[model samples]
Target chain A: MSEQDWRAIRAEAIESLLVERGLLDPADVDRVIETYNDRVGPMNGARMVARAWCDPDFKARLLADGTAAMAEFDFGGAQTEKLVVVENTPDTHNVVVCTLCSCYPWAVLGLPPRWYKDPAYRSRIVREPRRVLAEFGLVLDDDVRVRVWDSSAEVRYLVLPRRPADADGLDEAALAQRVTRDAMIGVAQP
Target chain B: MDGIHDLGGRAGFGPVEREADEPAFHERWEARVFAMIGAAAAAGAYRNADQFRHAIERIRPDAYLCDGYYGRWLAGLETLLREAGIVQADELRARIAALGGDPTRPGGARPAEAPDRVAYPPAGEGNRRSVAAAPVFAEGDRVRTASFGVSGHTRLPAYARGRRGTVTTWHGAWVFPDSNAHGRGEQPQHLYTVVFDGVDLWGAAAEPGTAVSLDLFEPYLTAWTAEVDT
Candidate 1:
C-alpha cells in the first residue's frame, strides 16, 4: 500500500506491457539508461571545458559555435542538438535554469541534478538568483552582472566557468579533474 | 495553458535541497521510468520532447505538486502510452494486481487520452527546421513578449508575460511548441535570446545588476512601440 511500492510496481507494469506489445525492447531500455548513466555525463563536459581552458583556439571555436565545436569530440545527440556555451568572467556571471521544465544539456551533462528539477529552484532561481547562488555557496560581487539563462527552447546552455585562481600550473587532464558539474552549471567556481 | 509546471516566479517555495553526490536516479524505478520515456520515444510512441512535456503539463495541479520529477515523468509516460494505444487501462490494473499491488489507488487508473489527433515530426529530427523566411526581429530589437493565453502547451513563462526585453541573440528557426503540442504541425519560427532586465520583470524588488534571458519563439513577441507606453 505504500506509494514507493506503487511506483515500483507501476513502472514494472508499464515496462512489461510495452515489452509484451513489442513496442519497446527491454535491451533498448537498458541501453538508453546505460548510455546516459555511463557513456554520457558531466565528465564529458569537464573534458570540453578543460580543453577550452588549455587551448585558446578551441575555446574561440566553442564560444562561436558550441554544437559544431563539440562535434569535433563526437559529442552531439539527444538534448544537445543545439549547445550554447556561456562564459563566466570577472564582470559577468552566468547560470542556467529551466523554469518551464527541466531542460538540461543531457549529452554534455548526462542528466540534471535533483535540485535542478526541484520546484524551489524552478520557481525562485530567476527571481532571486543572488540568494539562490549564495545558498549554493557562490556569492558574487555586487558589481558582477548576474545573467540567468532559462533554457526555454531546444537551445541548451553550458556555463564555461572561469579557470580557478590557482589553476595556472595545471594541464588539461588535471584541469578536467577540478571541474565539478555544479561549476559547469554556474553554481560554483571550478 | 497555465499549469503547475510553469513554476518560474511564484513565491513561497522553500530553499533548494542540494544533495551531496547525488546519483542520476535515486531509485531503480526512477531510472526505469526515465528510460521508459526514452524507449517510448525510440519506439515512435511520442514524436518530440514537446509532446512528452505537454503530457506532463496536463497533469492535475495537485498531483503535479505531489508527484516528484520522475514521478511526473512516469505519469506522463503512462499518458503517452495509453494515448498511443500501446497500453490499455485494464492491462495496467491487471499488471498491478499480478504484481501484488492494489489497483484501486488514484495513481493506478489514469484519465482518458485526448481525443485530438497526434502529430509526429520525422524521426531523428528534433524541433529545428530550415525555413527560408527571414527572422521577424533581429538582435538588439526592443520587443515585448505577447501575453499568449494559449489553452495548450507553451514555453512563455508567466513571469515574462507582456514584459519588454532586448533581443540579444538569434537562434535561427525552430518548431513552436504551442502548436506542436496539440497535434499541429511544427510551426517553425525565429527563435531569439531575449534579455530582460531584472527590474523590468520583478520591478523594484529585483536584485541590482541582474538580468534574465529566455529563448523565445517569434510568435511570443512583438515590436515594442513607444506610442503604447503608459
Candidate 2:
C-alpha cells in the first residue's frame, strides 16, 4: 500500500507487541468484541426494570444496590459496578449524560448512542435539560422536575421510569418488552 | 488541566447526531483498538480509571476535539502506555513504517516488544475503597468551592470552580483525582453531589430557572462563608 490508515497500523503494531510479549491473545480480543456486539444491550436493563415493575421488594434492592440487584439477572460487568438507579415519578424526570465523556453503563445499554457522546449533549443537557428533552420529543410538564445526572465520577445512572397504566397487569416479560433503552436512560417514557 | 475534553457548557459544537440503528463500532480498526485497550489493561499495562481518564484530558486540546471518540481512547491508551514505558516510541515508529509499506502486514510478526509495566503495579483500577480521612461536609451543608490555578489534571471542572453550591448528597469517600492523576497516592476525599443554580455557573448563558449539579470530591470544596456569596 502506498498510503494507509496510520491508526489502524498503530493498533496492529501495539497488538503484535502485546502478543509477542504473551500478554494479549488475539482470540481474547475477538471474544471481547463479540461480547459487546452481540451479547450485551438494553435488554439486560429492561429485564431489571420489568422485575422492579412487578416485584416491589426487588425494586427496593435495585434502587439500594444496583450491582447486587442486577446480580438477580446475572448482568454486571465493566462500567456497571456502581450504578445509581434514578426512579422517575410523575413529579420528577431524570436524564443521564457523562459531561466529561460518554461514561455510560455499557453493560446495560451496550455501546452508547452517538448522541450520548456528542459534545453538544454533554454541554447542554445539564444546563437546559427541559429544552434538550423537548428536542428529543419529550415535553415534560412545567411542574415535573427535570433532573440531569452528570457522570462526573465513577457511578453510572439508570432511569426507572414510572410503569405505564396499561402495563400494570403485564407479566415481567411483557413489561420488559415495553421498557425502551431511551426510557432507561431517562430520555423517553415507556 | 482545562483540556477540551471537559466539555460542560462551552459552546459552538453542533447537534447530537442520533444514528438510525447504530453498530458498536463504525470501523474495523475501532473494534480492534477497543479490544486492544481492554486486553492490554487486563494484561497489566495500565492506568487506574482516574489516571487513565487524565491521559485523555492531557491530550492536546485540538487533537482531543479532532479525534474520534474511540480514537481518543486509542490516543489515551497509547499515551499512558508510552509514559509508563510499556511501549517504546521508536519501536512503534519502525513498525508503523513497515506496516505503512505493506497494509496486509501479518499479525504478531512485529519486531518491537511492549516492556512489562505490570511488574510495578497496575494503574486504572480506580474504584471505591475505604479511607481514613474524615469527610469535611455532609448532605444539606452549604459549601463554597476553592479557586485555584491548577495547570494539571483536575476533577474540579473550570466551570464550577469557585462557585457556591449546597451539598445535596454525600457519595461517600472516593479517590481524589487531583492527587491520583499525578501518580500521587489516593488521598481519598468525600465526594458529594453539589447543586448549583444555573446562573452561578453560566450566568447569561444559563437557562433561567434551571440548576446544574455535579459530583465533587471533598478536596475541591470548603464550608460556605456568607461573605463569599455576595
Candidate 3:
C-alpha cells in the first residue's frame, strides 16, 4: 500500500481507540495535538535564544551551564531537562545532533520536531557535519571549525548562534521574535 | 544493571518498524509508566523500599529509552492520581504531615525532587560544585585517561578513555555520585579536559591540526609525565 494509505489507516485506528477509551474527545485531542505540534515545539527554544542575545549576562550563564541558564528565563516546564547551552562563535561553530538517539533539551526548547530527530539527519550529521549543514542551506567557510555535539548524556546542549548581524539594537522580545529553533541548532542562521 | 543514558554505538538491531502516526507507542507507554510510579508513590501505596526496588528492576532495560520512559511515567502517574481523586490537595498536605518534615524518600509525604547531581541550578547561577570541578592539571600538563575497563554506566566513551590528552579546561567540580542521580549518594570528583591531538586519537593517519578535547571526571584520570610515557 502507499504511504498515504498507511497514514490514513493509522489515524483511523488511533481515533477509534481514543474514542472508545474515553481518554480524549476526538475533536479536542486533534486540536490539542495540532496546537502542541505547531506552537509548543521549536518556537520555545527560539524564544530562549532571542532572550539570551538581548542580555549578555544571561548569555554568559547559558554558555556556562545550559539547564540553570534556561531556568533564568523561566522558559521550561516539566519535561525540560537542565539546559546546557553551547555557543557558536566565529572561531568555532557548534551544531547539535543526537548520534545515539534524538535526545534534545525539550524543556526549554520544547519538543524535538520531526526533522531534527530523523534517522537520516542524526546518522549523517555527526560524521559529516559540514555537509549536512550545507544541505540545510547553511554553508560555513573553511576558517570556521564545526563542532558537532552529541546530546547522548544527561546534559542537553543548545547552540547559541552568534547574534545575527542585522539584529543589533533589537530588544529581548524583539530579538526572540527572529530566533528560530533551526538557528539554535546551527542548521539555519537567523 | 544499565543506567538510562548508556546506549552508545551498540550494533545489531534493525530499526523496529513503527507506525508513522499515533504518537510513538513506546514513548506513550514509558511516559504512562513514569507517571504511574510517581502517582503510586505519592499516594503512599509504595514506600521507598518498593520504589527503589522497582527502579532497580526497571533501570537496566534499553538505557536510551528508559530516561524518557521513566520521565513520562512519572508524569502519567501524577495525572492519573489527580484524575482518579486518589490524591487531593489536603491529602497531599496530610502525607507531608505524616512524614514530619523529612520528605526525601518515597512515600515520605513530599514528592521526590530530582536527585541533586542531576539537578542543575537555576539559570544565571554558578553550577553547584561537587568537588569534581577542580583540575589537578593545566594546559600543556600531561595526563592519561584511566585504563580501567567499562563496567556499568560510564561517561568515558570507549574510544576516548585511556588515550592521553592535555588539561585544556577545568569544568567546575560536580558530585559524581557514581550514578546518574546522587540518590546513590555523592562521589564528588573534579572534572577536567584532556585535549588529545587528532594524531593521538586516530593514530598516524589523523589530520595534522585536529585535536579532540574531552571533559573527564577526576577518577577517570591520573597524573602521568614523560617518566611513564610508554
Candidate 4:
C-alpha cells in the first residue's frame, strides 16, 4: 500500500473516513472503483457494428446470435450476456427504450445516459417516439416505419446503426470510431 | 394500486435533456451507494434483484419520483439493508448524520425479507429462467392486456392496461417478476412482444401510422375475441 498506489494516501484517507462513518468498508470501496474502471462502453459495441458492416458473415452472425458473436470480440459481462441486435435500415428505423426503467445493454453501450433514465424519456418515448427522437435531433422520414422496442424485461436490445454513406473508404477501426453511443441507442445516425 | 413507478404514458414529467458527456458516477457517494448495493447482494443481504426493485417500488409515491435516481438507490439500499438485518437503523442514522444529512427520513419502514428467500446465486445471473409450458398466445394474435390493479410489484405499465394489441413475437417463457418479487417462486411465464397501435392506447390524438411495441409477460394479457360484447 506504499508507492505502488500513487494516490494511496488519499485513497486510504477517504476509505478510513467512509469506514469511520460506517457508510462503506475498505475492501468494498476498492471493488467499486474496479468495476467502473473496467467498462467497455459504446466503443466495444461500435467495433461489433463496424465489423458487421464490413463483413456479411459477421453481420449475419451478429444479427442471429448477438451474445456468441459478441464473445468473438471478447466483450462479455452482466447485461451483455443476452442481447438482441436490432438493425436500422432506410425503410425501417428501430428505437430502443425501457419505459419501465433504464434497462439497457450496458455491456455494449455503457451506463445509460441520464436522459435515457429520465422518467420523461421512459414515459414519452414509447408513446411518441418520433417526437422524442426529433428532440434528440433525429428526424425520420414520414415513410420510414418507426419500431419502438420497449425493453420492459429481460432480453436487451442494441441498434445496429446504418453505416453512413461517407464510410465507403473507411476501415473497421475508423468506422467503429464513428459509431456514437446515441446512434447505437437509435437516437442518432452515425 | 398502480404505483408511480409504473409510469409509461402518463403526462407532463418534462422533456428529456441530454448531457454532453456523462460520467458513470457523478459523485463519490453515488459510486459508494452503487457498490454497497452490489456488495450487499454479493454478501446475501437481500433476496433477489426483483425484491430490491419491489423495495424501491414500495417507496412512498411522493418520494418515489422525488428521490432522484441514485438518491432512490441510496434510499432503497438503506431500506433493504435495514430490513435484511444486515445494518441497524440507528447505525445508518448515525452515518447519515455524520455525512451532514438527515437520516430520520430514510424512506419509511424497513421491509421484511421475502418468505421464500433463498441463497444468492454464484454468478450475477438474475431470477430469469426458462419455462417449458406452452404459450397461450403467439405472434400476430390480437390480445388485450388485463387491466387489473396490483397492490404489489408488477411489470405491466399503467397506460398499456386493458389495451388490445397484436403479438409481434413470442419471446419464450421467462421468470415471472410479479411472483419472483414476493419470493412466491420463479414461476416462469411466457413473455411476448406486443405491438399496439398508438390510437388504441392513446386515442385519436396519436400519429397516423406510429405504434409502440413492448415486451410483456403472459399474465398481463388475455386472448382478444372477435365477437363484440353486447
Best by DockQ: 1
lDDT (C-alpha) at residue A138 in model 3: 87
Give each model's whole-structure lDDT: 0.87, 0.75, 0.52, 0.75
Give the candidate order by descending lDDT.
Answer: 1, 2, 4, 3
Q: Given candidate 2, what's the lDDT at residue A145?
A: 74
Rank order (by DockQ, best first): 1, 2, 4, 3
Q: TM-score winner among the candidates?
A: 1
Q: Candidates 3 and 4: which is better by lDDT?
A: 4
| C-alpha TM-scores of all predictions | 0.96, 0.89, 0.57, 0.89
Clashing pairs in 4: none
Assign candidate 1 its CAPRI class.
medium
Off by over 4 Å in 4: A1-27, A30-34, B108-128, B228-230
**What is the clash count for each candidate, in the order shown?**
0, 7, 24, 0
> Candidate 4 at residue A188, lDDT?
95
| Candidate 2 CAPRI classification by DockQ | medium
Over the stretch A1-190, how does candidate 2's per-residue lDDT look in tens digits? 3212756777787777777877677787667668877889888899999999998999999998887887777887888757888899878788898888778997788888777887888877876778888888898888887777788877788999899988767899999999998899888889
Question: TM-score of candidate 4 restricted to chain B?
Answer: 0.89
Fnat by candidate, in order: 0.80, 0.52, 0.01, 0.48
Q: What would the per-residue lDDT of candidate 1 be over residues B136-161, giving only the tens digit for each residue? A: 89888999998766777888998999
Candidate 2 residue runs with Cα over 4 Å from true position: A1-4, A166-168, B101-126
Per-residue CA lDDT of model 1 for A1-190, tens digit only, reads: 6768888888999989877877667776567668777889999999999999999999999999999888998987888889999999999999999999899998899899988998999999999999999999999999999999999999999999999999999999999999999998889987
